[model samples]
Target: MRQSTTTIMDSQVNILKYNQYFLPVNLKVAKTATTLNAKGILPAGTIIDATGKVVNDGTAFGIVYENVDFNNSMGTENVSVLIFGFVDASKLPTAPADAAKAALNMIKFM
Candidate 1:
């Protein structure tokens, strides 16, 4: 018998530009391994769509508030969605598109 091990490194990106006051809503995120994050770590500022999957289209629901480790699990997990706040776009793993920006008007992408 053989055993294998995998270690995921910690995230160092600061996605939130300003969060002194913001609105958060609990939502279920899709557990699609490839879509969530290629490195298995979903960083903050990632735009979520109606299907709870990562979307770069014009339709955006909200922004992820903190780092979420999917651990390569194929199941949904409830995460905090920032409806209103300042997010640093440069810090995001995949910056949202203009349509996403328009959809998430409440969130200011700096």
Candidate 2:
């Protein structure tokens, strides 16, 4: 038998500027040197590449839709990525680089 556990956390503020449209992609998050939040979770709005590695460069693929704590039994975890939507940049953990912003053309950062 196999078992899995999932923890649900709420965001204080909505990162999406509007509900017009948002695309969610399931991806296996890769372990990286990127710093985690106080809760040891990769916060929502954190940018990542197609390989699921945290990045702030032009290689950015999409934004995380929820907090993810992959430092557990499993070395990697599947997470939801927002490929398209209007996001409030101010709510992001860090400001995305110009190259990254340009790469995510479908995502509009307010």
Candidate 3:
């Protein structure tokens, strides 16, 4: 995923659409990337991590997601980031300057 794609403070978190491994908004959620032939779905109110990480709460039923990112091809170099933590809307770091901007913009809308 391209870092710094959006601008939202604490709101630019990405969703794990389909089944692509992605960084969790927070670090408490469990994330896993899968390679499926068709679009997958996740149940609403699934309590996903800030970074779109799904928590392993003893659930196995996958919900049907409608977003387009989930269907992204998952093959060689299809790796995605996963993270979870206390989200900060105004704290921007330098290591991921791109993501910092994207996240700030995203939070602005939230």
Candidate 4:
């Protein structure tokens, strides 16, 4: 009988998102998450692209989802959710044209 071995390598920072795991610039699910409900990774210091005027990559500017301040009731219901994800500083409409690069302007909803 003969034995074989396989190896996988990665350099991207680990992140969690999309009910799946990803390694920055990559959206493939990890082998261990085959049966898990959510298994994804997001690279730190990374942003999702939102400037279609500049590029059409889904991996654009940083995107995130968060629910801060539960005081504001959308339907008279007292409920709140946490926040997550990444965004770029420029993509933010409120962000000045010359805004710094260390900021997020996009978001995702959970």
Candidate 5:
């Protein structure tokens, strides 16, 4: 018997109306080779690369709140985008060594 493998790729970003618990922060990001939009097409849960670019294959740093469009000048510019999203605590530079300890600290302090 022979077996085959399958791969799935998501190209569209989800645009949400509102998120009550979401705290969004803006980031200046550049376009990757695969990105189409000037604002960039980053789906929720997408990861950021070392150069501060959004890569589908990188380690996640945050979750996109909505489909964002940064280039309102109609492609006349290729400037870095100012996008916003919720930061992933686990990916934070100052994230605690212990998950439980982080959760406890969040509950007690924040």
Candidate 6:
């Protein structure tokens, strides 16, 4: 059986100045086997896996905007992520449109 976890990183902040076209979204991400630093930034252009977990090897869903990890425990945390429409092209040039569509669908259900 797979374990499902949700982690909250940061509260909503003003991102209008950065990308007027996109909105910042809060997502529940599962903690990986790797250790995460407290108040660590996930950086922009982070890819999210199909299960809604942030991963290095997965479809590009959104760009993280200096999100900080609040939970120090080896679990999940809620993090702020910016979707494709708002992310700069330089971030993920090869991001698939289908992936963005899929992410939007997932977010809608969430």
The models' CA-based lDDT, in order, is 0.75, 0.83, 0.29, 0.27, 0.36, 0.49
TM-score, candidate 1, is 0.76
User: Distance from true position, residue 61, model 3, in Å?
Assistant: 20
Q: lDDT of model 6 at residue 71?
A: 48
Q: What is the Cα-based lDDT of residue 89 in candidate 6? A: 37
Give the number of the best model, judged by TM-score. Answer: 2
Give per-residue CA lDDT, model 6, range 3-37, as digits (tens): 65667655643323444455567776666622344
For 7-103, candidate 1 gives per-residue lDDT tens digits of 7667556677775757888887777622655667767777787666778888788877777777744577777878887888888768788998899
Structural similarity to truth (TM-score) of each candidate: 0.76, 0.81, 0.20, 0.19, 0.34, 0.45
Query: Model 6: residues >4 Å from true position, as ranges?
Result: 1-18, 33-41, 54-58, 70-74, 91-110
Number of the candidate with higher lDDT, 5 or 6: 6
Q: Highest lDDT, which number?
A: 2
Residue pairs that clash (backbone atoms under 3 angstroms), model 6: 7-76, 7-77, 7-78, 8-77, 8-78, 9-78
Q: Kindly list the per-residue Cα lDDT of model 5 for residues 1-110, writing each as its tens digit.
A: 54655334434443323333344455545443224343334444333433444543323333334443433323332322213323344432233234333322211112
Cα lDDT tens digits, model 3, 7-97, are: 2222232333323432222222122443222323333223222434443332222211222233222422212232323333222211223
What 10-residue stretch in candidate 4 is worst by lDDT?
A: 73-82
lDDT of 3: 0.29
Model 4, C-alpha of 83: deviation from truth (Å): 11
User: What lDDT would candidate 1 get against the real structure?
Assistant: 0.75
Worst 10 residues of 2 by lDDT: 5-14
For residues 1-110, what per-residue lDDT tens digits would candidate 4 score against the true structure? 54645333234322334434222222322223222112222223323233211111343343222111212213221111112443333433233222223232233322
Candidate 5: regions farther than 4 A off: 1-18, 32-34, 37-40, 43-45, 49-52, 55-58, 70-110
**Per-residue lDDT of candidate 2, residues 21-43 (tens digit):** 78889988765645566776888
lDDT of 3 at 83: 38
Give the Cα-based TM-score of candidate 6 against the true structure.
0.45
| Candidate 2 TM-score over all chains jointly | 0.81
